[model samples]
Target chain A: MMRRKLKVAVFKFASCSGCQLQILNMEDELLTLTDAVEFTYFLEASRATAPGPYDVTFIEGSISTPEQEELVRRVREESRILVAMGACATAGGIQALRNWLRLDDVKRAVYPNPEWVKALEHSKPVAEVVKVDYELRGCPVSKERLLSFIKQVLVGRKPYLRREALCMDCRRKGNVCVMVAKGIPCLGPVVQEGCGAICPTFGRGCYGCFGPSIDARPEALASRLREIGMKDRDVARLFKGFTGWSEKFRKVIDELEGGAR
Target chain B: MVSGGIYSGKFGELRKLFNALRLRGYRVIAPKLEDSVIRLKEVTSFDEVPYGWEDIQAPGKYSVREGGKHFRHGPDAPKRILYPPRLELFRLRPDWSVEYPKERFPPTALFAIKPCDLASISVMDRVQGGIGDPYYLALRKKLIIIVENCVEPGATCFCSTMGTGPEARDGFDIAYTRLDDDLVVFRPGSDLGVELLSELNIEPATDEVLRKYYDALKNASLKAKAPFELERLPDELELGLNSPVFKEVAERCFGCAGCNMVCPTCFCFDVIDEPELDGGAVRVRVWDGCFSYTYAEVAGGNFRKDLWARYRHWVLHKFAYWVRQFGVFGCVGCGRCITWCPAGIDLRETIKSVVEWVRSRGGS
Candidate 1:
């Protein structure tokens, strides 16, 4: 008897679709992946949609719309394993930036028909509404890593990954740190590892695309930033970026403000 | 074989060795003085080595100085040479339709490799080789390692904690420890090493010579300061995930990924399709870092938007999560992160604070 292929579905709600693109970007691995799994639903890659009960469902975007909120619940109920594929689905993502702003103002700016526009009060990750078997964090997940995750799942084993900060990779690569050599501020000591330390190589700093790492010490990092001559506003602006709406980051920003007040 | 396994030859013999290797179709690369840095470059002779040079490195300064004697390794030489700033894996076109030729790679030998560098290769092997990285494997396969045991240890040298050293280990094909009287003792590790020894017609090592060589290495290791004790870090980090310490650290983090660039074992990468001016394109992978705000962001939005969360993620991944997943600590105890951090944030101190926090919270 021939073995059955794993029925996989890729879903997106409110996102830049970069994570989905990362999947498409797996040029060499795509052929093998397509052969191994049945792509029953992936709106970006295919217009043909299949309904319900997928073996594995990958949710890429956050639930920002009321319709999406219900859709996520249905997807969660229908899938055997639900994996949050990017920052938007794992965390509130960039839309979480709206968490700090007035929701009415955002609606008015984006919708000429504010009366017709219907959205959730707050944007939230898929896990907030549904159970997620695994969460792959990143603005755009690394294709190499995504492939590894898929392969691991296919092979019936937990994925092996390094959960260290980017600083660890920075040290291993032997790049002269912008923080030390150029006196540039760097989140490397704290940011999660996954991206291959790219920005710094190209003379840029980390923007915290992977979401708050497990066990991050924002208080200590705040004091260090002050020592380097950064002001409270700068600190707040820094937190208010990609995952700016993350509860932990918001709390730190609030603390900085409270201290100043 | 001659006595003491020592080969006493003039500096001219070094050039002759390179010439012979070149004639045999091997590329000889060694440290050469370039832009005041000891950079690895193709060499034809001893004249190309950074002779009579040294460097001084401190908290935020690096400078090259002249040595009084000829053919002596510099004291303050930057270790950055061990890890190249950029290494081409394989170039691809933008369309992902084609890959570059693979014929440019030729078997080569890196002469005068320090024991610290040799140890770094072993660490890299575990990351790149063990992880199914064909690019690193191909580059590593065609190279021969010739190590020079540390005759002089740098102030920042602490390979002892990492179990690396002033002495060579299993990775090297041959090891050389410099001795007084202009002589060098060679220890062969593989058949190639043995053959090289035989070709050079070196003497057998005497008990006294071997004793002296080991004694010097041991002293070098001893002279180095001990790294901060971090036995409780992994557990401490797991419990401190919700602590304010991460927030504090993130406030100062500039989000620069310099640490990743200088690291010896980081293997994360991004694949991009580069289109030539012509129609064809190649898909290639380049190094990437998670410290950037966009590392975890999807097209819709970023997840680790906060610098604090990103910062905390890095530390936890290295010390705690990596161990839980890979059955080995991601860190090799190299002090490059601490020494190279522009903000002067030391990982040792950061981990120690976590340990203290865990103990205070009754979690340790």
Candidate 2:
């Protein structure tokens, strides 16, 4: 007997929608993916909205509003598996940059009518509000990894990720060490392995787009940067990019500042 | 102690031995002079050897010249075998499905490997083959190494500090030391080496002959320069990390990944699925670098946006983080990164800067 196709839905909240665009960018694999799973709701690709009981739900963006907070909770209730797609859904994305500053200042800077703007002070990942079964990391998740995750989930298999540092990928690509040769500051060691170590290939250092990796000793890395002639402010600024609002990166940055005197 | 074996007639006799081994189905690879570099190339005869030649190497320059019949190796002479700039790790189909290409792993006999090059291979083996990489293990399993003691260490070499030298130590299957009058001293380091020597039908050496070989090798090791003080590295690095030295060095950085590419120990990689027009795709692992801006960036944005953070990450990983995780220092003191860096960013100077900065900051 043929079983019913798995109902999948892709949801977005407050974001640039780049993660969804990355999904659409998987042009070659999209047709095959569509044939394999039932995409019941993907508003970025379709205007049609479906209600309730999704087999799998991929959530992008972060919770920046009270409505989104409630909506995420209801979505979690209806979905059997909730997967956070991209850094926004997994680590609060760049919008979380506001997490470091004062709330009133941000409200005044962005909204003409602060009283009408019903917004949360800080941007937050889906996991802050609801449970997440899986997380596809990166500012925009790697297409290879995204497809692999989808296929693995469909087949009920574990998708294995080589969670080494970006340095490993850098070394494998045969790129000269930008730090050693060019003295460029890089984040290949503490950053997670993904995106095929692209920046280093084109003569640039890693920018930590994948967020803080497992056991990413950023404090030690920052200290090393200082030895190599980097300023404390530069180090602080480095951790403040992309995943700056993440607890791990924030703590590392705070620690670099000597624990706020 | 010096060791001696009977004169195996002409140097051509060694070629015959290689050919005989090949006839017996052993894949023979030897150092051949190609485009002024002593590259490991497959050869069937003695004529293919880099005869009557030697190499000169320094920062940003490499040249091999004829007329020096003495088997001298240049430290800067591009160690292509130990550090292949590019290797087809695996081929992929258009689709993401992967197929392990059937590699011809014949019983390989690597001839005329210099001591420094030999030591580099051992270091790489400890990282790639020793750490549960069945792939590297397979390649290593079929390899037979022949270490040739360098007559003169290259100008850029500092193998002595890393405890590698112009003389062979333990890892080789066979060791050779060049002496006066075209006489080569051979020491069998393994049973296979002994077997190969026996097949040559060379007479055993007297104690006096053996003594000469040791004296030659000992002198070579002594002649080599010492590497940096590796013992003080971890603490020095810790102290250095907070110093103002990085900025000065980073100012000269052009963000080129040449240093990592030339290094034998740098083994980071990235995996990608190459989708085919067909329903299948091949997943291939390729070399990657940390210096690139996108190495850590995800879909939304980058994390280590600054050049300072990225550079610090690379050095710290090599010195501090790798030691913490692997229980060993990541660098092998090859100095290739220093010599190959177009900007001439010397690693020794960088370390010195770190040390000075730490001292100024009152760091221990």
Candidate 3:
């Protein structure tokens, strides 16, 4: 097997920069990662940034502003492969919850001068702006999975990312089903796997930080949650967590919030 | 059918069997209370077993309280230990040859396992073994089963309807039935079980005590409620393939395959050749099921593209297809699928719905 010399870049939009920090958090893998690819533009780790047309680019955060919308489109053209890294980049993160509110009302509640707020109508994923080659889903992308994705890319293999629901991983870990044992409503069954059942392992329902699974049925889960004593708004709020702006979840949130205060 | 002489022991004597198995180099996997639920995990000593703990199971509810029978558990199936959720079939070598994993399975004893779970392994033998699944067969060979009679069946359990539970008839080395009178009837069904029985140093149960144990077993079998029988289930499912009940069920089904993951006899898997970080590609098979979005996907497209089709396929496989494929119903009726479903879609109700739909159409 032959190894190819690859240059990598990192970009960020509107986010807490946690996903960008995850690259730096790879303390042990950084050595092997350094050996695998040249860091051309990882602003979080290095000060000296290189020019574009990079081999691979990891763009973190969501497109929340017009400037970010244009920037993401530019980043997509400048890279051989553009990978959306984290919930904000892939499904608009927790900040995207602002999508549910009326634009004027939301602006009035948050800012003193509502007219000066230059945010987009909705905080959208990078895919909504430009084409994304790959997506690493989570609130602040899993460092382990990101490392494997990079390694697989270096080997010219399509990385096998698990698209199964969080409940499957939860069951595999032998964590007793929290929703069944307790009456707590969980979004695990509709949420995609990647976080390794972090919330359910800690005896809490999943907040769906990793976004919807491929076979997400929010309507099914929302109805079941209602049976277990959650109001429509409560169930809607659960789906409206991190990845509420995603298509599958957005429709359900719309239907659920209908007459659901 | 090996009805060996029954012996009586106190509630404390089960530890001796746990110890005897450990002395024989077997890891004892038993029911232990952890994280507010009973887990079928490996226990080094008998103290880890959740004694006097009773599990409450409903369509979507599962919780444990300390008051009743100790040999009860929920959701966590024994199929996981035999045919693990994720198994590496082989590694693809450089020359396009394959290298099987050089892993060894330790001889393990499943102590105090309910009879329905034990029957599931028997179903797996016919399914996996008939299909020549080496991993399950090898793991099955290394297993030592110690069956425990389930006297206090959970609300979701209908093993009596499945006719696989409340008593262990065969395929187990040792069987223990705890009576309400604080005595346990121990029976050895194999040579190894008889040797382990010798460690107890207890006399054979008298005729009176044996009769009492038999009566208790019979009474316990009657304790479980049977919602329906398996005799007409296969036909009903097949005849009602277009049943509206399936679409109705799908409306509430998450199609997450949580039911399939916890299903004891579910043997479907997806094989993928993944490139290792070390440059070698390994072929691994993880637990996949009909409910999966890509489970039925082929080159052109997916077969069960709709959730209704997937849900119908899952129910039909257990009730209808397995009977045709393996000459046995895939469902042992342990009700893990019923209990663990996040959406609370009761399989028993789904079956009933299908039956009603079929009958309403005059198809069955």
Candidate 4:
């Protein structure tokens, strides 16, 4: 008896396409992955789209427009299990920085006729429109982690994803602490792990591309940054970068600003 | 029998020791600067060790400057070589049979290690050896630990407070202190160290050279301030749990687990299974820490969900609970955690906060 291959779909909304590019970057493991699953609706890879209820759907990017909002809802209805991939689908990505500015102003800056553009007032993660079964987070999802998630899903087991700070990975790699050793302001403490602490290992601070971890204490980290000579405005700006619209970072920035009064 | 007395080992004898160890079929592992950070790596020659280069480390600041006589302990400990970041436990074959990985402990000599790290090895010996962990036991059997007595302790060192350093009293094969370019003193702790010293044909130190070496050790001790008042620490820490101090420190904690990973005595791990296409699996153990959200998590609930609670647990386990569990302080006061922490949250300050809290509550 032959086992039926799992039907999978990859969708993109509003993003830099880096997350989808990561899937293509799986050149070595792509054949192995294809053996287990049928990529039914991956537009970036194949022109012929297969329409159906997919066993699993990997969604990249955020719901930034009315059409995207409708598309995500339909994808959710069609997919049995929907996994949000990368920062955009998980926490709105760098585009979420627009949430801090007036939508009309941003639209006018980008387009000649602001009213002509069909866009939502604010970019939102997939979870805002539909429930996400699991999330693989990073600027672009880590290749190893993404593969692990797929493996687990295939075996009908829950994927093991660590909800810890980037500092954990940095320490595991035995990289000298950039913030502590170099006096560089790093966001490793507040940012979620999965980038393998790449920035810190390279002597730069983490920019929180994975968003906040479980119960991330950005306020505490913020105060420490101030103690280490980071200006309050800069500290606030730090929390407002990629994945800034997420609850933890948004609340942290709000609290820091509130404390200024 | 090895007698424990200081002997004069010439400054140029290090290259000889490296060659001697290599000749004896032992790979020498020593500290070397990589990407401006000192790391423990396998070395074939004495030049590989970062001699005459000391790191200037402070709270959230470190720099490797040239022309310093002290060879400080970098963040890498000997445990990394022995325990390793990842260890394969076993492999599950397609036939449903399990195959245990073969023990591959190499004949190795860990050179120029610190006294605090030597103390950590003893603790690990008790923990892993007592439990009969084959991986650790095999590695332990093959290791020839050669430590350096602290002539100039780092800015973050507090080994004097922990009573674990400035000079290694035991557990190492050979312990030596560099006095200057002209003089070096060696003390043998084991029969192997004595044999190595004799094979190198090292000359005995005069009382005058020994006095200078001891004076350097004393000077290193005076430089570090050991903040822990160990006698009242357990009681104070227990009561201070409800105090506001834990929250104060937790406020600065990014939950990075840097302290846990760098600390010589920390021994926690997580095991995972990677399944293959043929229904086979490779089981592996990776380092883990309490700072991770999943560390205390279980079905439907997490115990130490709050960052402050987790922070308090780490401190208490090191100072209070460890004595009850292992009869040894978990922290060797190496200050690796303080130096490696991104936020520069010093454990000394946190302990002081606990002391202050204790004082506020009628001086426990």
Q: Comparing to the true complex, what docking class would candidate 3 get?
A: medium
Question: How big is the positional error of residue A154 in model 1, measured in Å on the Cα after superposition?
Answer: 2.6
Candidate 3, residue B248: CA error in Å?
0.7
> Which scores greater on TM-score, model 1 or model 4?
4
Model no. 2, DockQ: 0.05
Model 4 ranges with Cα > 4 A deviation: A255-261, B1-4
lDDT of 4 by residue, B1-364 (tens): 2355778867888677778888999988998888777888998778879988989876656778878888688888877987887789999997879999875878989999889989989888877776888889888999998898888888888988888888999998998888888677888889888888776656677889878987888888887666666787887889887889898778777787878888887888888888765557788887888877787789976798887898899999999998888888888878888877777788998998888888888868
Model 2 local distance difference test score: 0.68
* Residue A137's lDDT in candidate 1: 78
Ranking by TM-score: 4, 3, 2, 1
TM-score of chain A of each: 0.93, 0.94, 0.95, 0.96
What is the CAPRI rating of model 1's predicted complex? incorrect
TM-score-wise, the better of 1 and 2 is 2
Interface Cα root-mean-square deviation for all models: 9.6, 9.2, 1.6, 2.0
Off by over 4 Å in 3: A102-117, A259-261, B1-3, B89-101
**Model 3 Cα lDDT, one tens digit per residue, A1-261:** 556668999998999999989899989868766776888988888899889889999999999999999888888889998999999999998988887777788899988999998989988999998999888999889987888788778778777787878887787776777888887778898998888888888889999888999868888888888887888888888888889888898888889888431
Candidate 2 chain B lowest-lDDT run of ten: B1-10
True-structure Cα RMSD, model 2: 10.7
Residues A62-90 of candidate 4: C-alpha lDDT, one tens digit per residue? 99999999999999999998999999999
Output the number of the DockQ-best candidate: 3
Please estimate how well model 3 matches the true structure, expressed as its whole-model Cα lDDT: 0.84
